[model samples]
Target: MRSLADLNKQGVVSFGEVIVDYISNNKDNTSFKQFIGGATVNVAVRLARKGISSTYLTKLGDDEDGVFVKEELVNEAVNMNECSMTTTKKVCKVYVHQNENGDRIFHSYQNPTPNEWLLDSEINSHIFIDTKVTYFGSGTLFHEKSRRTTETILELAENFHQIIAFDTNIRLKRWESAELCKKTIAAFISRAHIVKMAEDELLFLTNTNSVKEGLAVAVKWAIPYLFVTRGKEGAIALHNQQYISTEGLNVTVVDSTGAGDAFMAAVIETFHDKGLPQSKTDLEELLTYANGVGAKAVTKMGAL
Candidate 1:
């Protein structure tokens, strides 16, 4: 395994959308509060907070919401040198509603300039020169232009010999159809070195009723590492065709908006610090720590 010292110079690059989340402040969903949030954004910020060097790559609109997102990333000490700013791209906005149990529900999304995204021609390979791992999700794949850009980045990452981590942070509303969503995600999964998905996502993609069955189907993808996270039930990992599970933490839940992103950050951090797991024991430890990080994220109101 590579030592931490050998990997400290290389950071993780997070590529996806950054949205201004307008969360409901009351049960009626009438009142709202704005927060900088997104799946990949939360992961990048959480990784920075954990003292890991993190770089965020996304195209932001030169608007107030975009400015707010940039300032927040700056406050979190996340590197944004590769991020793009343009007047054509409006920062995406999402409305989050909470149930009685404080679980987040995506009520709606507003994006006036849906087609504008980071273009493949604008992407510079230098961004991955010091990157050990490149992380992305399926949120941006709904757009044709963005999907091409994503493919380009993934190809570049592969050429650079960087670890590719894919988080199937599925937002069904973003895609036109569930069939398309599943097909696109499967294509990406085949290229990932590590894959993370919620238990619900596992069932959706594999059409399985249980985690074990889901793993049995996904194992054919031949991904080096696969994790299925079950909220409050802990998590499960499938490595080398073997499965291991862990119990979730019991904590007072305030909000569950960014829990999964926190878990992804923890997983990436472990890989950065210790390289890939050498044994089942090593994989088990990664799951336990990731579950704890996810549990801790829900104790707060906002993702950051």
Candidate 2:
């Protein structure tokens, strides 16, 4: 018989933004439903929910929302040893719009706060010495200090032979321009061992209108594996030279708040459950599980 204790898994570390997401029901109403968000944060919390320990690295503000975010992390059992709080804070808002069929679209976003101080703290590779994987979001590049911090982590990962994952969570509203975003995203993808992004991010990175053209661009990157989320169309995985796409699940989306994050967390959990796929069939099966995880995530109100 399989012991239940055998199900417990090793923890992972996530580095990047930690934002308070204010999700509105409609474009007209900007008030309702608040949650602790940010792509990597979502991944960490979900992994924790799956019985995995997670060390979160980022800076929070010494404010109400920051306290709320801290409490949420505590409730989820995410390690906050690397997390710090400063004197100031900012909240990011997501105005959501849903199609009649329950597809969520983030119509607008505003992020007036930034965390440059978090990067000032020297990088400590020792803290991640035993972590299962080190995951981060590309949005961290928007700031000079945070960008250096990200690059440093990648460097340490390379030196230590640690697994590194990157999520290209492109929020157009926060970028100065799409071209700059693409340049930075492309650079990060080239260095990551595992990369994940939504279908739209592929389009932006490739500057194309069609998925096929976008894939042509996606495949050129140096990443060992790539995960692309396509909402109702499910997700596709590119490993080695093969591409495997799984059918999307039908779910009534309350909000698309953390669908991609959930998908990435599932991918990590799958890798933890079964070592990173070594064959084409294994990759396909892994992506199918990821799509299912993403679908289930949308049935809720926020990332968690």
| TM-score (all chains, Cα) for each model | 0.95, 0.90
lDDT of 1 by residue, 61-127 (tens): 7888778788889889999878899987788889999777656798999988988899888788988
**Can you give the lDDT of residue 216 in candidate 1?**
89
Candidate 2 lDDT tens digits, 92-124: 556566555555666676666754446745566
> Over all chains combined, what TM-score does candidate 2 have?
0.90
**Clash pairs of candidate 2?**
none
- Measured by TM-score, the strongest candidate is 1
For model 2, what is the C-alpha lDDT against the true structure?
A: 0.78
For each candidate, the alpha-carbon lDDT, in order, equals: 0.87, 0.78
CA deviation > 4 Å runs, candidate 2: 1-9, 91-93, 97-103
User: What stretches of model 1 exceed 4 Å from their correct place?
Assistant: 1-9, 100-102
Task: RMSD for all candidates, in order, please.
Answer: 2.7, 5.0
Best by lDDT: 1
